[model samples]
Structures are given as C-alpha cells and as structure tokens.
Target: MGYNHEYQLALANTEAYWADQADRISWFKKPTKTLTKTDFGTYSWYADGELNSAYLALDYHVENGRGEQVALYYDSPAAGKKEAITYNQLLDRVARFAGALKAQGIEKGDTVLIYMPMIPEAAVAMLACARLGAIHSVVFGGFAPAEMAIRIDDANPKMILTASCGIEFDKTIAYKPLVDKAIDLAEHKPEHTIVFQRAMVKAEMNRDGDLDWIEVQEGVDPAPCTPVKGSDPLYILYTSGTTGQPKGIVRDNGGHAVALSYALNNVYGMHPGDVWWGASDIGWVVGHSFIVYGPLMGGCSAIFFEGKPIKTPDAGTFWRVIEEYKVNSMFCAPTAFRAIRKEDPEGALSHKYDLNSLKWVLVAGEKLDSSTYHWLSDLLKVPVIDHWWQTETGWPMTAPMMGWDNPSEARLGSTNKPIPGYDIRVLDGDGNEVEDGEAGNICVKLPMPPGVAWSIWNNNDRYVSSYLEAFPGYYHTGDGGFKDDDGYIYITGRTDDVINVSGHRLSTGEMEEVVSAHPAVAECAVIGVNDELKGQLPVGLIVLKAGEQIEEEQLQTELVKMVREQVGALACFRSAIVVQRLPKTRSGKILRAILRKIAAKEQYKMPSTIDDASILPEIEALIEARGAI
Candidate 1:
C-alpha cells in the first residue's frame, strides 16, 4: 500500500509517464513530441498535439452514449432554485454560447473575460471559450469595480460576460453596473458585453455594445470545436502579487486536459457516471480544475453551489446537499470544517445525513490542523484527504491517492506523499537538501509535471525570475516545510509566514497547531509581530466554541503553557486574545498577512476579496486593547 512504484516510474522518465497520460484524452492529432525545452527556462508539453478542451470534455461523452447522465447539478438556496443539467443539455448550452461568441466576431486565440456568480452560466461561458479555442479569464463575482478594472486593463479581453445580479445570503447585488464602471476605467473597452438577465435587479445596458444573452443565442447553431496546438493558452487566472500587480498564470490546452483526465481516475478514484462536487467558485483555480473541466473530462457530475457554507442556512447545508444529490466525493476548504465544528461541536447536525455514499472528503486551501482533521474524520467515518497545490500548478502535488483494492490510511498532519511526476524536495537557503526533522523551503525539481504552469502570461522574465531563478534548477514553492523519514511531507508554513524571534525561525503553523489543540479553542490563527527586544513574537488570535467561556487571563495562560510545553520557550508565544471571527477571503483562506499587519501596527492595504470587511475593525480593536498596536 505504498506509492513507491508509481512515484519511481514517473520520476524515472517523466516524458513517458506524461505521454501515456496524453493518450487518455481524445485528440485530433495525437502528440508525437512529449515535451520541448528551451534555454530561457520554459517548457512545452505535448507540443505537436491538436485537441480542443471543450470537445474532449463534452462531445466525447455524448458520442460515447453517456449523454443521459447528469453533468451539472446547480443548487442555489440564495436564489431559491435547484436544477440539474445532463451531458447533452450542458453541451447544447455551451455550444450555443460558443456559436454566439463566434457570431460576434470572436475567433480562436481571442481573450474573453467572464465575471459571474456560482451559476451554471459561469461554467458554460468557460466551456464556450474553450470550444471556440478562445482564452477566458474569470474574475470573482464579489470583486468591486476598481478591482475588475485592474484585471480588464491587464488582459484587455475582447468581450466581457456577466450577469445582472448575484445573490449572496439573502441580498441581491447588482453586477452590471460594476462591469460598466470597469469598462469605463479600462484603456481598452471590450467590443461586446453579454448580460445574463436573472431579473433579480434592474440593470442598465449600453446600447452601443451590450447584448442580451438570450437574444444572442436565439437562432445560432453550435460552433465546431477549433483544434489548436497543445501549447495554446486556455485561461489566465490572476493571483495577488507583492508588487501591487496581479500575476496572470496561464494554463495550456493539451497538458491541462491530459493531467486532469489522469487525476480523475488516479487521484480522485472517479469513473464515468459518478457524482463529484467541489464547493469552490469558478473564479479560482480549484473551480477551473475540479468543478468544471476535471469532472466533465471524466464524464461525471459536478455541483455548482451558490450559498455560503454557514449563513446560507446552517452548518448542515453541506450534509443536506450530499443526502439530496447522493454525492460520491466532496471537496472543500479546511476553514469550512472549522466553521461546522464551531456550530455543531458534538456532530449534532452531521449525524442526520446518511453520508455512506460519501467515500472521501478532501481538504485544501490551507493546512488542515490535526484537531479538525480527526474530529470530522471520526464524524463522517471517511478518509479526510488533505491535498496540497497552488494556482500555478493546476492539480494536486501531494495527496493520498485512494483505491478500493488498497485503501490508504489518513496521516493526520501530513498531506501524504507527493503525487507521481512531482519530485518534491526540502532545501535550505543555499539549495542543499535538509535532514528529515529540519524545516526548509519546499521545491520541485524541473521540469515540472504536465499540469504545472508553463509560463506567466506575457511575462516570461517574471516566470523565470519568480519560480526558476530563486533556486537554480528548482521551482521554489515559497512554502517552508519538512519531509518525514517515511516520505510524508508536513507543510510548516509559508517562508514569508515564518516568525523570526531573536534570529530563531519559528513556524506560525506549528505554533497555531499547538494552540488550537486546547479543548475550548474552536479555531485560532498565529501571527508574527515585531518587537524591540525579541525582534518578532508569536501572537494567537483565537475563536472559541459556541457558549464556551474562560477568564481572559486564565485562557491566555493556558494557551501560552500549551505552546511552551510543545514548541519550547524560543516560540516567544506570550500573548493570546479572543476574537469573534477571523478575516478571510471568499475562498476561506485566512487573511494572516492582514492580521500580522494589525499586530505590528503597520500600514496595510485592504483586499477586496475579504468576506467581511467589517470584521477588520474588530481585529484592530482587539489588537489595540492588548497593547500590541
């Protein structure tokens, strides 16, 4: 039950391994070349391949007679609706949208920006772009006009797709006005704007360029799939940059399809006709891989959930959806489990559903603490797979690839072993391999897997300098961790997230793990704050379980003692304070950098992705009360 054979085979000859994966997808011209390298730190996989991403994801399944099976299950409690679309139906919608785009003068290689909610139209728009061999860039729906403008200026999309309104909780937020503002702000205005009229709110449309979505698709025929080279760009997903500009991470057509198709069977244990649900938004990389392309490539069902994890109803929302849809496997962030645990500590709401159909629950986005991992695993009686990857790398780099014949046991804190085709290493600052117990930078030897990003859009220099130049022949992950003697990788924290106390490096993740182990603590975040004496100190911001109470002095003492006993005195973990909630992005990633800024009383820019901007003031108040500000 070890992955030694698979891992060894892939690393021995990556070209052979990736070539076999490429064969899994249907192609017009099968690739004769596996990978091509350049002197400027760039690579192209399946160079001579000719295939359309949408054709493989949609047409292949329908031609194989699996069209009757469900392909998209959309449930939006906030919109007060629920529906499912079969493979045939999904294909028709995507094709019509593709035809509409073509009719508007969009051609292969053209870029389109899609900004919509968690509705099925978002997925359709992405597929439509792929079907016509056009690149699609999807921006998160909650983004403001200013934020949208920044992306529009960067990509200069030919067309923009959006909806009239998006429902969050019970409120209907208009999106058209924001699109119009972004168009006005951008130096390059899109030629056409297609609007999906939900009728939830009144929206003004510009007569010169705006077109109703329904009218555009009224009499158009489905466009034929365009066969592009394997290296053709599929999408551009932007990630936050340190220099106040976004990094446009580009995914190619052939390699992405091949890698994801391989993962459907190997990483997810998925087959045709099965249901897979990934409760992530289409704007992010996770949604691009899992919620849309991955499941569709496997000819399986994927859910598009349009509701908050907690406030949409209760912590029971996920369980109810599972029972209703009979979901086979589910994927969500670790913060979700923390929220569910906060609401129902004793499994009161979870026990109501029959999760027997749920074989696996995967957690990502952030490190899954040992306490939450064990709590939810025991409740569901299923393997809680903690996988690790980034936006640049489309799919998981480390995971416990489960199987019916040989099941893998859950390793509480580890993200299990590195997946095949990924040669993971822990290296020191000088690029030397570290001992098993020592923490260092996590890196991957070049060339990376097929699914890994080939380059940053329009910025080959940045791609080389950002990932390659840091460590000569390695892709610096920007994360710090260690590999155990048994080959299990434990991600300690981001290298930037490490706290330097009197020149001793202390991982905030390790400190957070110790503090979160306290029985009364529901969740906690550890941050490093500058100090005149120690240089930096670890501060714990805790959120206790519902109705749980303890004296502030006594609780702080307990938390300090826990860290001292576990991580030693060098941790400098003296302060602990309570907070009602932590600031997070809509994707459930904690805003630790913001917390660190508040702790050190340093100026910080407010991110537009924050779920609740109001909670930021609360954190500031708590910091001020503790004299840390």
Candidate 2:
C-alpha cells in the first residue's frame, strides 16, 4: 500500500493501529488496553504494560549475541578524546552505574540531575537512571548557576552528576564550581554530588556531600534492569527556556519505546546494525530521542559526537565523521548547514569524503529554506527530509514516511505529511479548519499519541492551559503554517513570529525564504520591528556566502526589491543589514524575539540558552548602525 492507504487506515482506527505498532517491542507484561483518556484532558498509552527502557536499549542487543558490536562511537575533537564502546561494554557500565546509584539511596521513583557535556558518561548516567527506574533530568552544561538552580529547585534530584569541566570551542569550563553555586542558590540541595574528572580541571568537592565518580563505580557490580509500569516516567526533559520558566516534559517508559522504535525503523527507514547519527547536544530532546535512546532501542549504533560543525576543524568535520563511521543516516539543524556553506562555498570539503554511505539527510529544529535544502541535496545526491516536532512531542509528528514499497518524492520546503499516529490540522482564529493554502495555528487532534508528554511536571493546570485550552480538544502547537494541496505542510515559523504590517499578517519565514534565494546570501533571518507608521515592518539580517561581497547599499536595495516582488509592498521591507552571524540559541534557533526587542528598544531579559552572550551586544550595535542609516 501507498501513503494514502496507510494514512487512511491509521485515521480509521488510530487506537488499533497504534496497538499493532506497540507489538514491535518486547514487553514484560503485555498491555490489554492501548489508550485511555484521563479526566484531566490527556491520553495515556500502554497503561498495563511492564518494561524497562534501559533493557530494550542495551541488554536486548547483548543478549542476542551482538556483544562485540559497537553501541557508542565517542569522538570529541575539542576535548581531544576518541573511543568506541560495544553493546556488552555499555551494558556493563550502565548496570554498574545503576548499582552505584542504588547504593546511594536512589529508588525507582527518585530524580537524578545530570549536568555534563556530550560525553559517554552523560549517556551512561541517563541509562543508569533508566536501569534503576529513576527519572533523570539533564541540564545543559553551558547553563549558568542561576539557570541550573531553577531546574534543580523544580526536579529536587537526590544526586547531581557532572564532570570536572566542559569543552566549548577553545575553552574548558569547570562544572563543579557551577554545581556548587547552583546548590547554594536552589532551595533544595542534592544529597550527593558525583564529579567525573574529564578535563582534570582541579574542581573542589564538598567532603560531606560530594563523591568522586570513579570511586563510586570501582567496586560496583552489574545490576539487573528494574521493570516499571508502562505509565512510569522514563525521564523529564526541560524546554530550552526561550520564554518563561521551562516546562518539564515527561516521557513514559512503554509509549516512548513503542513510538520511537517505530519511528527509527519505519520513518527513517533503518534496521538493526544501521549507524544513525543525530548531531545535536544531548541536553535537547532530539539528542535524547534519536542520538541516545531511539537508535539504541531500535537496535542500531548511535553516534555520540562531541564537536561543532565548523569550529572543530573545518566545514569538513561532519563529512569526516560520516566517512569515518560509515554513517547510514544523519540528522542536523539547518543552521549547521548554513554555517558550513558560509565557510565552504565551493563545496570542496564535501568532495574530499566518500559520503556514499549516507542514505538521507534529516533536518529539524527550524524551517529548512528551499535554497539550503537544494544546496545540500544537489551535493549529496540524496533526499533531504525536513521533519517537524517539539519538546513536548517526544518523536516526529510529521515526516516523509519513505516507504519500503513505493516512496514519495520529497517536496522541497515542505515538512512532509503527518506521521501515522498524529491527526494534524491547520485551524483559523475561530478554531475552524482553514483552507489548503491559508496559514493558521497547527494543532494535533485530541488523545495525542503515546510518545507525547504526560503533563508539564507537577503543573497539570498549566499544561492544560498552555496547550489544551487554546484549541479546545486540539493540542495547540503555537506554530503558524499552512497545508499544501497534496497534504504537505509548509511551516511559516512560530505564531508569534508573524508580523502585522498595516493590518496584513505576514510571516518572517516567507521573507526569509525570498532573501535566502539570493545567490550571494548563504543564510538570513527576518523580524518585524516597530515601524511607527505601519504598526510593524520586516527587517532582514543577511549573512553572505564566503568570499562573496557586494556593496551594502546595493545589497539592501536588491533585498528590498526582492521582498516587494515576492511578498508584495505591504511587507514594507526596507532595512536589510549584513551581519557576520545571527544570534541563536545553543540548539540553533534564531533569537528573533531578542532581535525584535532590541529593535523596539524595549527591556528584555537575555535568554540563558543563547549560544554566545557576546552576540547580543553585537546585535545591538548593528541595530543602532541601521537606525542611523
């Protein structure tokens, strides 16, 4: 059957279809009911099943006699480290760590805080939590003591797992000092602080509450995986904290396993022994799902890369890793490709490596412009799949389900169609379904699939108000996009990203798309600033390709004319500033809100997730210069 047949079947009987999908995993106690709606306006999946996420990810492969196969390929160019751990070795480490955690009074439902860089121990810590049935909350290593303190206060973890230092670009930051400061700032302090010496940065440890990480595991023995109810939470991953306080997104054991298992095999078209690399930081949801858990549980080797796309060596870092590992499929952000293209305009770096091993390229996190998509696709001669999902949804909600029988051609700039278990729709202001080409709020129909979050930590009412209340029974995605004729989705940025110029709502994504199509422009971001006359007007920030330069006045004129021709003059697009780089979060999301705040001269708090805090002053100076012009 084709896409239509499978989609229709899923739509007709979603519960039964999802039930069949759950059968792909090994459940200790099989579930009788697939889905049940709670009174609080959320759905629970695989309620009666019993299983362990760690066992599925580690033990199953070793038990099947694939002991010698590599499970994690550790490469950290910044830290000057490289190693490979097989499935059997990984299982031994995980079980030993679980036993150590158990010795420290960690029970099944306890919480553990993990604050470390993209190291193998980070994955080991997460899996140890899973093996012992504890809920692990991993804070990004770059976060400040204040930011880390907030999550610490919320999760109230019994233990904090961190390393001596984190390697970022050319600097090594000691993590123990930050952990100590956060513990002081937090209302609740963790009982124990486990410090691993990665950088040998000479970190101070509290004699009473701190323990050396190596000491804890010296005499520990491997422990058996602990089974949990299907509804038991696997982990709580916090949002990147772009807006208000971050919401703790909870993913359960059984549903998460089932959904991701199906996604890894069916959606991405991978099987056992395939090498899938998700080039993302482990702090984010993508890393947790695809990089560590999803691929491992799907019976494939997941690459844990500890390096950046450009600064690690050159623009060739990604290709080198792929060639070195023979990576079958890979995932990265659009920003990464933009940076690489900016550095290597001739694509000479890509020519050096034999990228024939790559089957496809998967991109998410932001809208993938048609220009960048074509640029990469033309070079690799492989299909580029741009999928869309969020921190709340644990897996891909909409992606090109490349079939085993008859695959569909990937439509450029479209985020494919809704995946099997999601009933996605675009709705108008009044909550009615919009026309095919009209942009509206993107929402998922009620009783969201299993892999979705249970609630926003302990704030159920906030979860209801934040997602459910906005669209009634639908889960409001806070995104504004339109569906094409063939059911493909064209995401037009977030709902707040829409600018009203003279009462005409225009998407920054549309303007950015036009600007990116410029031959000289490698990447661009568009935002609306206070126009005083038109309510708001679009201003573009353009980053040119390497070794390509044009007169500033001429560039602005061409971009203004292009926006007028494409989006019409009501866009009032006039200012286009050439910048060295756009300010973005660590996860590579452009800080448009920060840009808009700077343009309007309004007081705005700097987000802790910003990749480079120095970029903010640079943006301010650029805006001031543009205002003078």
Tell how far residue 30 is off in model 2, in angstroms: 0.7
Predicted candidate 2 versus true structure: per-residue lDDT over 413-507, tens digit per residue: 67888887788999998899999988899998887777999687777787898898888989999888999988888788889899999999999
Question: What lDDT does candidate 1 reach at residue 289?
Answer: 96
lDDT score, candidate 2:
0.88
**Residue lDDT tens for model 1, 1-629:** 34787789899989998887787789999998999995677788987899999998899999999898889999998888898999999999999999999999899999999999999999999999999999999999969888889899888899999999998888999999889988888888899999999967866876579999999998888998999989899999988877767888999998899989877778888888888999899989999999999999999888889997776788898998999899999889989889888988887897789888998899898889988988988899888899899999999888878643554556777888888889999999999999996899999998898978878878888889889888999999988999989888889878888989999988999998898888888899999888899899888999998778787789999999989999998897999989999999989999998888888777888887888899989999988888865
- Cα error of candidate 2 at position 152, Å: 0.5
Model 1 has an lDDT value of 0.89
- lDDT of residue 84 for candidate 1: 90
**Local distance difference test values of all predictions, in order:** 0.89, 0.88
* lDDT score, candidate 2, position 78: 87
